[model samples]
Target: MRMDEQFILRVPPSVAERINRLLSENASSSEDKSLDLEFSEDGRTGTFVIGNDRFPASVLDLPCVVESYKTYDDSALVKTADVGQMILVRESGEASPDVVEYRHGLTPPLRDARKRRFRREPDLNPELVQRDAGDENARNANKKAPPAAAAKPEVPDTGGNAGEPDGSDSDDSDDSM
Candidate 1:
């Protein structure tokens, strides 16, 4: 890799995801969208319509995978940054808006962040754990029958009869009275 040779930062898988997230957060503003983004070869050039702005394919960055025609590498499909959409950049000075390579790759800052995220998972925060446990308890509470309520047996009334009534006992026996 030389200063003049085409070189990009090699990134880990976890770092790549974080970079994408940060980029989304950065681009969330309306003002950010108004700022022109310029990139090259993203399938978006001539492929998308954005209001009155008709951006050509030259303005998008394409996401790329390093697919070597030579099938002899350890990881045959080299992981590479493929620009996806043309980014419209704000004009510098009086110059025209230029397209540049902006990629969704892992940079140092995001790499560290991703590492921290994965590494810190085992150091559980008691508060967060409690909150999650509380939520789970609430969700399951409806399914559990409480012991106090369950202990009371339902007594079925057989109209005061002791399972059977002797037929010799007549109801009209009170007629003599």
Candidate 2:
């Protein structure tokens, strides 16, 4: 449904009966017998108020109410005269109850992108990106050095005097001891 369009919400029979009962009960005591339907910020939940008493209400199959209250700048007001049986919600003036079925969730409403606020593009630094790339290149070069060192031929060790740092005669060293 359009943001500015008027829609009708068919009140359940149980709720309508209770409202009528409340209206009749408060007719003698209370001066204001008007039905007030106030929706939560999310529009999924609502309350029906008459005089001093309040009744909790759940909004069923009305995604447009949820979308309008959450996204658009338009505000919804229910006519007190239309409070009996069904509710007529309009931006400004009165509307017929015949337009109720079209506003249901059968056909998804088109959202106006122009009315919605989108996130701005993020700011990036060219210097930081270049520095990160350079650091990665250095790390890759260091990683290559270890493999190259491992590829070198290991020298085979010779037993006895060949393994020793200094060459000496064994019999001569024993005589000195």
Query: Which candidate comes out best when scored by TM-score?
Result: 2
TM-scores for candidates 1 onward, in order: 0.16, 0.25
Q: After aligning candidate 2 to the native by TM-score, how far in Å is the CA of 121 from where it should be?
A: 31
Model 1 clash count equals 27
**For candidate 2, lDDT tens digit of each residue in 50-151?**
555565654443323332223244575433221112243332223223332223332334343213323545677999989999999998887744444456
Question: What tens digits encode model 1's per-residue C-alpha lDDT throughout 1-177?
Answer: 633213233233443444456457665542223323344464433222222343333342333323223245656754344333333322122233254544332344433343454344488899999999999998998686666645667788767667775556667755666
Q: In order, what is each prediction's RMSD in angstroms? A: 21.3, 19.3
**Model 2: lDDT to the true structure:** 0.51
Where model 1 places Cα greater than 4 Å from the true spot, the runs are 1-65, 71-126, 142-177
